[model samples]
Target chain A: MTRIYNFSAGPSMLPEAVLRRAGEDILDWGGSGMSVMEMSHRGKHFGAIAERAEADLRELLAIPPEYKVLFLQGGATAQFAMVPMNLLRDRTAACYVDTGIWSGKAMEEASRYCQVGVAATAKAGGFTTVPPRSEWRIDSEAAYLHYTSNETINGVEFQDVPDSAGLPLVCDMSSNILSRPVDVSRFGLIYAGAQKNMGPAGITVVIVREDLIGKTIPGTPTVFDYKKHADNGSMLNTPPTYIWYLLGLVLDWLKQQGGVAGIEAQNIRKAQKLYAAIDASAFYSNPIDPAFRSRMNVPFRLADAGLEKIFAAEAAGHGLVALEGHRSVGGLRASIYNAMPEAGVDALIAFMADFERRYG
Target chain B: MTRIYNFSAGPSMLPEAVLRRAGEDILDWGGSGMSVMEMSHRGKHFGAIAERAEADLRELLAIPPEYKVLFLQGGATAQFAMVPMNLLRDRTAACYVDTGIWSGKAMEEASRYCQVGVAATAKAGGFTTVPPRSEWRIDSEAAYLHYTSNETINGVEFQDVPDSAGLPLVCDMSSNILSRPVDVSRFGLIYAGAQKNMGPAGITVVIVREDLIGKTIPGTPTVFDYKKHADNGSMLNTPPTYIWYLLGLVLDWLKQQGGVAGIEAQNIRKAQKLYAAIDASAFYSNPIDPAFRSRMNVPFRLADAGLEKIFAAEAAGHGLVALEGHRSVGGLRASIYNAMPEAGVDALIAFMADFERRYG
Candidate 1:
């Protein structure tokens, strides 16, 4: 079978090495005679696996000891509700920076729990830019400020971490986590859905500062309570064991790629190649401001909308899959996560050039 | 390596054939270059996988046309809250039967959203017997009646479906789903966590009546909203794709095992042999009433309680792993699901007899 590069916004491409290792161990993890999926969550084997996976993730992200990592279900979408349920207390409002689909979703869910103030919005710019830090309207009485570090749908990214003043800074890093090195100590909490650059869709990784724990509303479900998850080491409910195992393999692969620094260089170069290719041709255009263009998830449009189908079909023929943009924003989106090799970006660029030549 | 029989309450054993087939196909599913975990939820490959998985599940369960099958996350733990959120519709009261740890947890979470009336309790019977239906004090005006058909932790099950009398009858069938046949028409809704007889954790199977659709309160998160999941065909969010794939394999295995009816017979024989061994000896004792002993999860205590550690360690030495009972219940729980062969149960019985002779 011909090799293919998947550019899905989430549930995107994973390193082939991780895939191979996961396949080899799917049925009998470490000769335990049971698939990771079948092992008891409390079994010593899975217990060790879960701890090691979290430890490796901590090392990969340079997470501080004060931060508790939770392996939660329901993805980042669930966190949108959980964040407010856990953090939106003793405050008049929580601030949200609306960049794209995910941030808007966060705000919508938070509104159900507390007053959600729009601290900033690039919506006026058609979501083609991240609002400048100076333009933010943060509330002095805000419980916490929430933002998305990278927007998958609109291909917009906050190039710099916002100054939250005295409030805790929280971010949905779903589409951008592990694409580059990050200072974990700078934020109060960071959550990422695993499907983008981490591992799979079943698990969400939540890193929260220790001081932020133990404040859930009385009615919050146990699984959604960060305090409960941290207290039980993320096995409060039978966690997604197989996904945790797969993520461990990805973390190992990341280490082999010389850690986050090495992968970041490749991700930057790959995104640069695709964006450069799009910029070099009038037939294709990426609308996001260059200053805020995402290193992962580059959404672009063809000059002639009529050729969108042809571009997608021809790309698929060349082993480039899932390059279709999110339906919320109709165009093409190339998600160059850590696993998307430079070679894949080169292939996409080559395909884009050939398509332009044929259609222009 | 000695083959081990896993008696974990959940995150339990799967069909060996299913695990083998899953291992073979983990990296490249049906010639697709990507692992099912890496496929986009909206892509044709995964879309077809999800659709077929649901269709096969509905067929296996004999789900009525009026019931909408939803694949959700967060396990039955989350469903405890979701059940009240979507079904109670701000009603102040609902009726819940307290049978074991699982039912107690359901009530605990449901209490957050509504006034949960304890309709019946098996605790007085040492949590081994199901409350007689005639003694149930279900509030006539409650929004719905909730029960756990099979309690994994306590090894109790309600053999007969309760009459709803125009009220919705919701059940948490987490441990016993797909193990035996049931009348789907009797239930207003049924939700099962996939760790037991289904496939893996992270995916929940929700079969809701068509009338129970779209009643979620305004604050309900989109992921937990039954209406949202039903409207989008359970693709409201990126589901646990690999888990769904494994579940499909399990459904295929169930069909080959003569569907639910065939598996039910095997389960009956397995439970009967194990229970008979315990009852035939003064060395072993099961506290549960014989009439309500679960055919799936058989929890038995020893005549000499001081020998619990010795019994557990000896069993582990023999490769009968995860036989330790739930900490809350403090006894040995042998969860003999559809995957546990009669030979495995016989092995357990033989081991128990030998252990009793040595330790008694």
Candidate 2:
């Protein structure tokens, strides 16, 4: 059977190996004679899967023993509010860098819980670039600083981690997590919606330094409390079991792909190849600055704006799907996340070249 | 191809048909060239799946257009917190009937937001029976009256809907939803985690009266606000797409099974057959009141408690799995949800009879 390369921004592509294993196990996981989806969360089989996934993830990221990895639900959108609810213990104000759609959303949700300080914003540039860290206005007395490590919509990414000046730095790594390795000790908290670079849409991976948990605002919903989930190992409720199982397969796949450092080398090459192709063609242009262009999401525009629909449709016809950009930023986007193979990128680049030859 | 019958309480048995279809489509769903797990929530393919699932569910329940059906994440435990956050509008106290574990958890979470009146409780009876409505001391000035329709852990089911006396009645039908037909008009809200009787663990089915939404307590998390989900069709954030698709397939299967009424007949016969098998044998007994015993979860004890381990081990040896009761209740519990075929129940009864013959 032929397979189309999927480039969905969040609920994007998964490793074919992972999908194949998951398919085989979907009806009866590990010979237990039950689908993973049908297994009880408290059951020993799923418990082993959950534990192994966590251990694999911790090994992958070199997560400090002091940090807890929580497999949660409601995606990263829940974390937008949860971060403020749980982290804003005594301080009433928090700092944020408004890079693009994801962080902008986090800022809006957080305003309800505490006073929000837009320490830096790239909105003036139509969110096409990240503001230089030196220009950021941070409140020393604020609770914590938050930012999105990569903006999925605008295709902007951080060239270097922003300094919160000794304060806890919380990052929304929803779109770029596990694509590369970084120092875990630099941030107090990191969260990612599992749909993009991880696995599926139903789960969120929250890595929080132990000290930041268990101190949420009074009246905070128990489901959003970091302490409750961390304390219970994210089994405070029935977790998204099937998705959690899929994530384990994904972690295993990542390990086979040579861990984060190995994947980072491949990702760097893929992004460079795609970006070079875009830059070489006058027919297509990515307006984002070179320093901050996203390694995952790559949005480009045809010189002739009206041709966007035809471009998207033809791409789908050619077995390249979800090539349409976010409506908020209209054009064509190909999200080459961790699951995306170099072969898919080459195919997309080849298609872009062919399309330019036909149109130009 | 030997298959084991799984009797897990939640995340329990699913129809073999559903599992087979899901496994077939695990790599590519509906010939869409991608798995349902890989589809974007906002895309037409997933949108169609979501709309169709909602429509099928509505048709099965004969839900009023005046009521809103929300496909949410975070399971029923999240609802234990969200129900009060959203439903306790302008009211300081909500009345709850404490039947078992789930309802007790709900009251504990709700108390964090508003005063909770325990109108009635079955803890006095070891939670083996539901208290009569006449004995409930409901607060007329309260927000809404809440109860668990079927306590999965306790093996107690409400035979009839209790009077709310003009108060909006909310029911946690997590274990027993769609097992039988009920009057939706009588309930202001009905929420169920989808692991049992529905589809999977990641998605929750919340059907609420249109008038009861939009007035959540201040500082309510956006994801917790029922109105946002109702207005946006439960796409407030990315939904659990794979689970949603499975729920649609389940709804389709339900319609083919002659809807709720047809299934209720089968469910009754199954429950009666199993209960009879346990009651007639000196080797086994169910302590729940005959009238109030749950048709879904049938918890029983062996005559000799020491034989419980051997009974469970022997059952598993014979391909019956997950029959161990909840830790809170140390007994054997079989959750025969809608997906549990009558033939499977027959197999269980057969096993019990044979075990008794050997050990009695």
Candidate 3:
């Protein structure tokens, strides 16, 4: 079987080992004689999977005991509204740093629950750069300041999460979560859609401070209500159990890759190699600001606009698939998520070089 | 392989054929050479799967072209909010029938958005019967009336969907969806969680009238916004691709089973045999009123509560799995969904009769 590197942003590539294990266990998970998909959420087997998944995630993230880890549905997009619904009490406005498509979306959703204040925006920079923290206009009385740690579409990433003074800070780390190390204590809430770096597209991981629980707006559905989910071990309703099981496998894979710090070293090298290849060729260019180019998603453009289709086709021939950029932003985006091997990056870089040789 | 007769309530038993097909396609779906779980939501493979799934579903349900089918996440619990958010415009109150746990939860969620008028409640009847429409007190000035077509937890199914007098009717068919034929035009919206009588747990199927497209309260997340999901063909976000694919297979399976009408006939026989066994036995009894007893879920109790554990254990040994009742109401619940064969039900009945003879 010819293995291809998938760079489709999300619902992207998963470790082949994990996939094999999942397929093996699809019909009989860990001697339970039942498929993980067929197991009851309340059953002893699934309950253990859920518990271990949480414990593994906490350990992987070096999460504080004061923070509750929630495995939720509806992805990070759900958390865009849930954050304010659960935290925007006693505050008139919530501040946001608009970096790219994700934070822009976060801003749009947050506006529904609170008076949203744009503390900073990278729009003027064509969403290619993260706004400097010193340039931010934060409201001291804001409930929480929200930002996307990495923008999947524009391939922009924050090198550092901002300090919100005494106020809580929230980050949508959907695209680059678990790709690197971070201090968990700096943020009051951290949410990541599982599709990109975690596992599949169904589960959303939320790490929230204990104090943020039970503050949901009255109109919040019990399912999306953070307190209700947190109170009931994220099983207040039927969770996406299969996806949760897959995530557990991914977490196990992460541990084998020498944890976050070890993965970060590899990620830094991979991103640098890909970026260097793009910068070296006049045929291809990544316009993102030098300081903020995402380590996960790398977006670039061919010098000739018409070659976009040709470039994608050629890449596919070489078994490097899903290299097309976001539709809104036309070009090429190679999403080298945590599951993406260094070999895949090398293959992509080699393809870029070959394409440049013919086109340049 | 000894196949277990799974009687789980919502995340219930899937068709054996569907499970086998799913297992066969676990790694390479439709020759795509990628696990359905690994496919990008926007890729041709998943897009085709999603489109065909919707098309097949539309054909199966005989859904009108004017209606939109949304493959949403978050299950029926999320729909409890999406329904009121989309349909409660210019209406201060909505009518709801309290049939059982699902309807009660829907009412609770709806109450947060609008004043919910109890049209009729079966709770007074110990949640064993569906109140007659003649006993309903629907408000003329109210928004759409809502009810659960079948209560999975209480083993109560509505024999008839009440006429809404030209008003829009919304039904939560979580337990009984695709179990029988129904006129689609009578209801403005129908939502079902895909675990029972459909496919898997991660996906929720929502069929909404096109006219009820965009009336979301400001606080509703764009992900849950009816217009947002509808306009994008349920692809506004990365959907639960694997679950959706599995649903399409299940839908195809239903069509092969001679559609909903044929399945309903089989379901009736299954429920009748189980109910007959319960009623004939002095040691076993089903509390649900006969008039409203569900064809899908049959909840029963032993005359001696002390024997409940023994019954469940012995049933498990006999391969009649997941008969333990919901935590709120402790007893046995055998959910014979569309995929549950009459033979499975017969086995369950036989087990019950033998257990009662030996233990009574």
Candidate 3: deviation at residue B160, Å?
Answer: 2.4
Sort the predicted structures by lDDT, highest score first.
2, 3, 1
Clashing pairs in 1: none
Candidate 3 regions exceeding 4 Å error are none
Deviation in angstroms for A191 in model 3?
0.4
Candidate 1, superposed: residue stretches over 4 Å from native: none
Worst 10-residue stretch by lDDT in candidate 3 chain B?
Answer: B25-34
DockQ of 3: 0.55
* Location of the lowest summed lDDT over 10 successive residues in candidate 2 chain A: A22-31
Candidate 3's TM-score reads 0.97
True contacts kept of 1: 0.68
Give the per-residue lDDT of model 2 (tens digit) for B36-75: 8889988888999999999999999999999999999988
Model 3 residue B358 CA deviation in Å: 1.7
Estimated TM-score for each candidate? 0.98, 0.98, 0.97
Candidate 3, position B312, lDDT: 96
The most accurate candidate by DockQ is: 2
DockQ ranking, high to low: 2, 1, 3
